[model samples]
Structures are given as structure tokens and as C-alpha cells.
Target: MSAVIESHGHDDHHHGPAKGLTRWLYTTNHKDIGSLYLWFSFAMFLIGGVMALVIRAELFQPGMQIVEPEFYNQMLTLHGLIMVFGAVMPAFVGLANWLIPMMVGAPDMALPRMNNLSFWILPFAFFILLSSLFMEGGAPNFGWTFYAPLSTTYAPPSVTFFIFSVHIMGASSIMGSINVIVTIMNMRAPGMTLMKMPLFVWSWLITAYLLIAVMPVLAGAVTMMLMDIHFGTSFFNAAGGGDPVLFQHIFWFFGHPEVYIMILPAFGIASHIIETFSRKQLFGYSSMVWAMASIAILSFVVWAHHMFTVGLPLAAELFFMWATMLIAVPTGVKVFNWVTTMFKGSITYETPMLFAIAFVVLFTIGGFSGLMLAITPADFQYHDTYFVVAHFHYVLVPGSVFSIMAAVYYWIPKWTGNMYDERLGKLHFWLSFTGVNITFFPQHFIGLAGMPRRYPDYALQFADWNAISSVGAFLFGASQILFLFIVLKTVMGGKKATPQVWEGSRGLEWTVDSPAPYHTFTTPPKVSL
Candidate 1:
């Protein structure tokens, strides 16, 4: 393959990317960086999946089987941290790096060099985090949320490393968000207005702002934790004249919007897939943009809902509960628009569409469960149970994870210049969907029956559901191998795809050559709705 591929821009002297390992190290190309982000995210996904298996294996029966209680806690903490930070966030950023420039007819991200730096820093961050698992006291086992005294007073020697690693990751996220904001705000092609931008771009625009707003809060929280542990500050220490509840306040303030940071890009992805597969213009394009913005705004206020059982005032509980519930309004608008887009239109259940539909249905289930948990009185019953586990997994796995898969299936043709095997793709989808339900559905029942979360051993009464859930988890984990195989096979070689890979697709991204050129729209192609 030639290092230089011809781009659609007027420049005839453009050169292709360099070959070999050096291509990744010093390159500022958005596409190469995007590829790096995607591959890195996949590796983290596999690593996290293995940790999850360790957890499920232990919980498969009434007693511990695979690992000790301490190790189990490590696995639990690492799994959550890796999946949220390592897999989901980076994957969405990769999509933004790859598609946002192309969709908006820009040459590349505004801060291309910073984009490269941000991505490269992630490995070290996660490396430091994972290395703590082998340290003398084991990894930070206070859970991914790392609530107050557990992360401070009783924490391991490795907690210092964990804190530094968190700081690094937060810095990376902040940088990535800045690059996205600059590129989207300043680099659009002439005549391309905000209202004319694709839903994906709009979603990312809102997401980028949310990331900028919240990542600093996370950094502050960790810094406070560091002071509490090392310098004897009592920001979250009751003995030192601080309130432990304050930690939850600070964490959730950042944590709530952080959840949206993972899912908003997914909303963009589902919108594009639904509209493209349905052969219709998005039913409520303007409203969809507003809805995403609305959701982002509401996210900041609802952070306390997660801490409903922490003895907040009744007024505070009512305020958080209603604010949290209000998010459903904008979210519901998005779902209704997707269905409306699909209504009475020529619909095809392609691989991407399959995943998109599953995301909608399963994510809604998560959303409804979230609403149930938002009820102050009801949350006291549901707090820290497997029901909470089921809720987030549904949102993240099928919700965010499925959307990432759908984006790959929907756009791989453009990225690779080859069409994936439809049959294999569908098979992967069905297996994943079934596996997810099998794994998570039983959890809901067990949780309702009073199975608290993060326990290595459960009473015999919870044994059947635990075993069944573990089996489903193993099945789901295995199905991902098929997904990897399908992706690799498609990349190796398949049917060649045309410029407009999907007939109904409409965007500047599809206007260029298939397997999109290394440099595209260098001359700033004109855009019009």
C-alpha cells in the first residue's frame, strides 16, 4: 500500500502517512490517533472483561471459588474503573477524532498535536493504575467511586499511585475535550453552520463542554483525597473536623455529569444509525440538539440523587429526586425522535441498525431503572444492590458499548473501503443481546430479593440466580471474540465498498473516497444543508 493516498482537496502535493511503528509515536494525524484510541480501548475492554470474569467466577456459587475476598474487591474496583475510564470514554473520543472532522468538512482537529499527546498519556495512566494491583497492599479497593475514609484513612500504600494515576487520566480527558471544542468551534467548512451540523457533532459539542466542566472537579476530589491521606487534612475525615458525606457530594457532583459524558456520544450514534437505516431525515433535528443540551444542563443538578440514602434533608432529597427525574424528559424526546424517524420509512435491519435498536430498548430499561432509583424513599431499598448493578450495565454495555459497535459497523466501510459480512455481524449482535439479557436480567430479580452488591459470598438463597448470571456473563464475554474476529476479517479484506456505503447516508464524510483519504477536505469543502 502506498504511504500517500490522494485526498479530495485541491492540493496535489499531499503525502500519505509514514509506515511502521514510528507512524504511531510522533504522528499528529487525526485518523492515526483515532485508530490508536480505538485499538487501545479494545485492549482495555478485554482486560476489564477478564477482571469481570474473575468477579463472576467467585460469585458463581454461594461461596468464594476463584479468588479471596480482598482480591475480589480489587477486581471489582479495577473493573469499574477500567470500563468507565479506559473503554467507554476513549472509544467515544476516538469516534470524535475520526468522524467529527470529516462530518464537518474540516481538515483535522484544531489541536492535532495536543490530540496526539492526550491519547498517548492514557497508557501510562492506566499502566500506573493497573500496577497498583501488584503493590504490597493491593489495589485501591474502596470501589471505583472511592468513597471517603475507605480511600483515605484505611487505604493501601498504593493509593498514592492510584491518586496520581487519576490525576493523569483527568488531565488527558481535559485536553481531549479542549481539542474537540476548538475544532468544532473554529474549523467547520465555509457555509457549514451549527444548525446544519450532524447529530453526532452536536452531541459531541455538548459532551465536550460537559467534560471540560466536570473533569476538573474530579481532579479536585482526588487532590482533596491526597491531602486527607498524606498531609492530614480532614476535608472528608470526620475525626479531623470534616464530614464524610461531603466526599459523596463532591464525587457525585462530578460523577453524575461523568455518566452523561459516556452516553451522550452514544445518543448521537444511535440517532445517525436510526436515521440512515430508516431512510429518513432525523424527525426532530433541532429538537434533538436542544434535548442533548438540556440533558447536559440537567446532569449537574442531579448529582445528589445517587446519594439519596446518605441522610440528606427531606427538601434536598425532593429537589434531587425531581431534578433527576426531569432528565427523562429530554431523554424521552431523543427516543421518540428515533422511533419517529423509523416510522413509515424504508427500514433495513442491517448490522448497525440491529445494535442501534438494541441500544434503544436496553438503554431505556436502564433509564427506567435509574428513574426508580431516583425516588428517594425507594432508593433506600435499592441502594448498593445488584439492581443498581443491572441498571448501569444495561446503560453502559448495551447502551454505550452497543452504540460504539453500531458506529463501527455503520462506518467501517468508509474507514476500510470494505463491507463487513452481514451474516456474521448479525450473529454477533444476537449473541451479544441474548448474553446481556441472560447475564443482567437475573440480577434484577436477585437484587429485588435483597442481594446486596460487592459481596464475594452470598446466602444459599441467592445461589441459583448468581450461577445463572455468571453463566450468562461468560457467554456474553465469549461472544466478543466473534466480534473481534469479524472486525479483523473485514479489515483484512471483504467486498469493496463505494463512496456512499449506505444508500441513505448523508454527510460530508461520505462525499470523499471510500476508506477515507489520509487527508480530506484540505481546501475546506463548502457545506450546505
Candidate 2:
């Protein structure tokens, strides 16, 4: 295999990316598509960040000063949708497109045309979703989850558009997942066995399976919503022999796994970053793989925990409580692996390491809060409150978002052949770190004091913390502008990078050129490990 790979003729048919607009539109090249996904996700991140600033500005005072209550609801709804569907999920997929083939020694994604189709559909999906705000009834105000009667009976005329957009997004996700699974399963270079594969590949493979299983469930849930709205079906309409709780069950059935779908890749990324900076082979490599697989499987059975506030029978409540809490075991195993990997190793706190460490600590805080929410009785106290918002944002912003940022910092040098300004990167990190805690830590107290989420106004008692939170929100949002600048600065020009960008980095990816070639592994490379 090694001889064949070495003897194979280099396919010079590949030149660099096509010039101009046609490069993005018609190209099936993984690198080009990956760049497209990353840029698109970043644009959505900025748009979503603006919506968040609006929400925080409204909450800056005790009254609805900045916008009308209706507009406020639209901001919150669009923020959630855009961040989840448009930013976080797509960013991970973008990472997968760029890294997976390199890590596995595949030349390209298994279905190249399908990959292009999957990515191209996203802009259209988001276009439909955003276009809804301009529609007569305004955007989806019922929240990203789009729970029952509110989403069905009381939803806007744009709900139909929202439903269609969701279908398009789901289709995109499913196709992307299929492409990932096929590439990983069948395209590994010779000698690159399953256990020897990097943690990022493992994480994404699990995530791909999870996506394949649940994206359809989400599509079905929305289709049922469409039917309830137009066809007069009672899928969620209690008056017509359907139960609203049924919608919660269906939505959450997809929603629980959906949360893991976003974070599991983060887990993968943290493993690589932690191991790299720690200057050690990853601790518990097999265990990390099993842990991710465990978390993905556990995600399925824990759906009902989100619906605990709604009327669930005693047995079902207890079942979900135990199931949700059980997920903590594998999750703890992962956190332990990261820490143990770093213990007594020559660790360096570079920008990626800082974010990875933050992901570990902050994500654990969110996990503990999640455990609190898992307790059926306690959730009754915390459900629908700002505390819930705090918990998820902690998990998402610091956990997933931080990890994504870490990946960009860690790999951008390889992608661009230019090192980002390390001082500026750390500065961006500190601002983000400070801003995130200041913004969310206070929400826990306000939530405990009986302030609910999704409200445009708050009581006088909630005024002060809300003001502080808004300040932090502004800081966090502004820091991302620095991030965008850093990325562009790195891409355009900076200190030149070596093939092995990080001193201790280990992977097939690092073996390639600094800015990996237009074509790689024309002949399947023989993997040593």
C-alpha cells in the first residue's frame, strides 16, 4: 500500500480554486465548500449577535424601552433559530468538511455533489426563515423549540414559511450527515483503523449518526405542525382529539439529541486541543470514543426531562430524571480524560488551550445546573426561568462556541499558512470569558428570584442584575468583532506558518503543506497509526 501510494502519479489536473464568483457557486471541492460554510456561519453569528444585543438592550431597563413587545419576541425567536441552525451546527459541519478527509486520509467527501447541495440549501433555508419577519404576522415568536398550541394555533402566517424552511434545513443536515458517514466509513487510508482515528473524527461520526436518526424526527414534528395548521389535523390541537403534550414529546425527542449533536463535536475538538497543548498522547483514547458514543446513545432516552414541567406521570418523570442524570457519568469520564491528559504534562496555555480549559470548567458548571434541572421536583421551580437560559448559554456559548473558536485558532494557521496574532487572540479570549460569565452568572440569581425567560419586561427587583447582564452582553458581542478581525487578519497575511503549525500537534493534517494542497491524498496515504 505504501509503495502504491508513493508510486502513484500526482494528479496535476487540480489547480487552485477557480477564480471569481463561479468558484463558490459551482465548486464541489471540500476546501472551497468548507470555506463557504465557515463564512456563512460567521455571517449568521454576527446577525444573531445583533439580535441578542437587542434582547439585552431591552432588558437593560425594567421596561420595554428599545422595541415593542412584538418585535422583542421576534428578535428572541430569530436569535435562537439563527444561532442554532445557522451558526453552531453549520460551523461544526464546516469543520467536518475541512478536517475529516484530512484526518482519515480521504481525498474528498464521499458524495461531493451531495455535500455541495447540502451547503447551498442552508442559505435558502435561512433566507426563508429571515424573510418571515417581513411577513404580515411577523417571524416565529413561539421560540426555537416551537412547542404546541403557541406554534400551531397562535403562530403567524409566517409559520408556514418557517415550516418549509425547517424542512429544507433538516434535509440539508441529513444529507451532510450521510456524506460524513460514508466518507468516514469507506474512505480511510490504508492502516487508518477505527481506534487509531482522531477524536474529532470519532466525535463527528457519532454526531453524524445522531443527525441521521433525529433530523427526520424534527422534520416530522414540523410537518405535523403544518398539518395541524392547514389540514385541520389535531396532532397538537387538544380540541380536535390531539394533545399538546404530544408535541413536546415529539419535539424533545429530537431536541435532546439535537443538543448533543452540537456539543459532541466540541468534545472531540477539546480532546485534540487538550492533547496537543499538553504535549501528550490523549489519555484514554478508547475510553474517549466510548464516552462520546455513550453520550449520543444516552441523549435519546433523556428527551422527556425537558418536558418535566408539563404534566408527566410519576413513572415517566422518574424515568427521565434518572436517564438524564445518567448522562453525567460518560460526560464526567470525558472531562476527567481531558484533565488527566494534562496532568504533569508540559502544558502550554495558548489561545486554543485557554478556550479548551474554559470549555471543561464552564461546561461542567452547565452540566451541574442541568443535573439540577433533571430533578423532576426542582425543575418545577426552575423551568421557564432565566436560570434555564443561563444553563444552556453556559453550555453553548462557553462550551460549544468556545470550542469552535478554539478550533479556528488551532487550525487557522494550517488553513491560511499564516499565524494569527497570539496576543490579540488571547485578548479576544479574555473579553469573551469575562463577558460570558458576567452576562450569564447573574441570570441564575434572577431566575431563582422568579424572573421568567422570553419576557420583554421585568419587575423592579430584577432591574439591577439585568443592567449588569446587558453590559456583559455588549462586551461579549463586541469581542466577536475582534475575533472576525483576527480571522481575516490571519487569512489575509500574518507570520508565516510551518507545516506543523503547533509545536506538539500530531496528525495526518499536520503532515500536509501549511495551506493544504488543492488536492491531497490523490493516492490513499498509508496511515501508520
Most lDDT-accurate candidate = 2
Alpha-carbon error at 208 in model 2, in Å? 0.4
| 340-374: candidate 1 lDDT, tens digit per residue | 99999899999999999999999999999999999
lDDT of 2 by residue, 284-362 (tens): 9999999999999999999999988788899999999999999999999999999999999999999999999999999
Error of 2 at 484 (Å): 0.7
Please identify model 2 stretches exceeding 4 Å from their true place.
Answer: 1-12
Where is model 1 poorest over a 10-residue stretch in terms of lDDT? 1-10
After best superposition, candidate 1 residue 420: deviation in angstroms?
A: 1.0
Candidate 1 error regions (>4 Å): 1-12
354 Cα displacement, candidate 1 (Å): 0.1
Give me candidate 2's TM-score against the actual structure: 0.98
TM-score per candidate, in order?
0.97, 0.98
